[model samples]
Target: MPTVSMLDHLVLTVADLQATIRFYEDILGMRAVSFEPADGSTRWALSFGAQKINLHPADGPFDPKAALPAPGSADLCFLSDRDLDEWRQHLQAHEIRIEEGPVRRTGATGPILSLYLRDPDGNLIEVSNALHS
Candidate 1:
C-alpha cells in the first residue's frame, strides 16, 4: 500500500475569515494570504514555514470540500520557534487566555513543551517546542 509521505497543508472551515486570519496572523504570527482562484472568490490561507492552513468559509460552495466542515472542530498542535516561556508571555501580551498546559506532551519526534489557547472560533490551538534531552 502506498502511503502519503508528509503533510503539505490542511483546510480549516472558519466562522469568520477575517477573525481567523487575525488570530493566526496577529497572534500566532502566521502570514495571511488572499488569492484569486479564477472563480472570482478570494480565498484565504494562513501560512508558516512550509505548511499552510487553507480557510474555507463556514457556508462554503467550495469545490471538493469536506463532508461536514465546521468551525471550532479542530484541535491543532503547532510547533513554535519560540520557547514555551516566550510563547506564554507572547500569548499573555496579546491578552489571550491560556486554557491549559505548559505540560509535557509527546510530539511526532520526541517530547515537547506546550501551551494551550483558543482561537477566535474556539479551535483548540497548541503551541509547542521540542524538549531537549
Candidate 2:
C-alpha cells in the first residue's frame, strides 16, 4: 500500500468564512491567501508554516465533504515555538480564554506542553510547545 507522509491541508466548514479568516489571521498570525479556481470562483485559505486550512462556507456545496461539517466539531493541535508562559500571556492579552492546560500531553512529536482554547466557531484548538530539546 502507498503511504502518505504529511498532511497538506484540511478544510473547515465555517458559518462565516470571513469571520473565520479574521480569527485565524489576526489571532493565530496565519496569513490568508486568496485563489481563483478554474471555474473563476474565489476561495480563501489560512497559511501557516508549511500547512494551511482551507475555508469553505458551511452552506456552500462541497464535494467529498464530511458527513457532519459543523464548525465547532474539530479538535486540532498546533505546534507553537513560544513557551507555555508566553502563550498564556498572549492569549490573555487577546482576551481569549484558556479552557485547559499548560499541562503535559503526548503530541505527534512526543511530549508537549499544551494550552487549549476555542475558536470563533467553538472548535477546540490546542497550541503546544515541544517539551523536548
Candidate 3:
C-alpha cells in the first residue's frame, strides 16, 4: 500500500473567486496563481509555503468535485511561526474579527496555540504555532 506523503492541494468552492483570492492574498499573504485546465477555463489557486488551495467557482464543477459542494464549509488550519500576540495584531490590522482565540490545541506536529477567524466566504481558518518550552 502506498502511504500518503503530503497534501498536495485542496479544492475550495467559492461564491466569489476574486473575493476569496483577495482575502487569502491580503490577509494571509498568499500568492494567487492562475492556470488553464484541460477544459481551457482559467482557474486560480492560492499558494503558500509548499501548499495550495485550488479555487473553483461554485457554479462550475471540475471533472471530480465534492459530492456536497458548498462554499464556506471548509475549516482549514495553517501553521505559522508568529506567536499569538503577533497574529492577533496582524488580524486586527486587516480589520478581521476573531471568532475564537489563542486556545490550546494539539496539531500534527505537537502542542500548538491556535487562533481562529473567518474568511470572506465564512470558511473557518485557524492559524497556529508550535508551543515550546
Candidate 4:
C-alpha cells in the first residue's frame, strides 16, 4: 500500500471564483500563486504558508453544487503561537463572521483559543493559538 504523507491542496468548487479568491487573499492573507486553464474553464491556486488551495469555477457545466459541511463538520485548523485576541480582532475588522470559540482551553491536546468561520464555499476554517506546554 502506498503511504500518504500530507495534504498538498484542497480543491473547492465556488460560486464565484474571484470573490472566493478575494476572501482567501484579502481576508485570509493567502497569496495567489498560479492559474491554470482547464478545458473551457480556469483554476486558481492560492498559497497559505505551506498549503495550497485550488479554487475552481462553479459555473462549469459539469460542476457539482457545494455541499454544506455537516454540523461539527470537517474543519481546517491553522496553528500559531500568536495572541488569539489579535486574530479575533483581525477577522472582526474585516467583517468576517466568526462562528464560535475564541473560547479558551477547550481541548485536551493543549490549551488553545480558536475562532471559526466559513469560507465563501461553506468550508469551515479554524484559526487557533496553543497556550499550554
Clashes of each: 0, 0, 0, 0
> Using lDDT as the measure, which candidate wins?
3
Off by over 4 Å in 3: none
**TM-score per candidate, chains pooled:** 0.93, 0.94, 0.94, 0.73
List, residue by residue over 1-133, the lDDT tens digit for candidate 3: 8999889999999999889989999888899999998889888999999899999889886768999988999999998887779889989999999989889899887898899999988899999989985
Off by over 4 Å in 2: none
- Residue pairs in clash, model 2: none
Candidates ranked by TM-score, best first? 3, 2, 1, 4
- Report how far residue 7 has shifted in candidate 4, in Å: 1.3
* lDDT (C-alpha, whole model) for all candidates: 0.89, 0.88, 0.91, 0.71
Q: Which one is best on TM-score?
A: 3
Candidate 4 contains a number of clashing pairs equal to 0
Summarize candidate 2's per-residue lDDT along 1-133 as a digit string, tens digits. 9999999999888888888888888778899999876778888899999999988888893666888888778899999888888888988998999999988999997999899999999999999998976
> Stretches of candidate 4 above 4 Å error?
37-42, 61-74, 104-111
C-alpha lDDT of candidate 1 relative to the true structure: 0.89
The alpha-carbon deviation from the true structure for residue 96 of candidate 3, after best TM-score superposition, in angstroms, is: 0.6
**lDDT per residue as tens, model 1, 98-118:** 988899999999999889999
Kindly state the number of residue pairs that clash in model 1.
Answer: 0
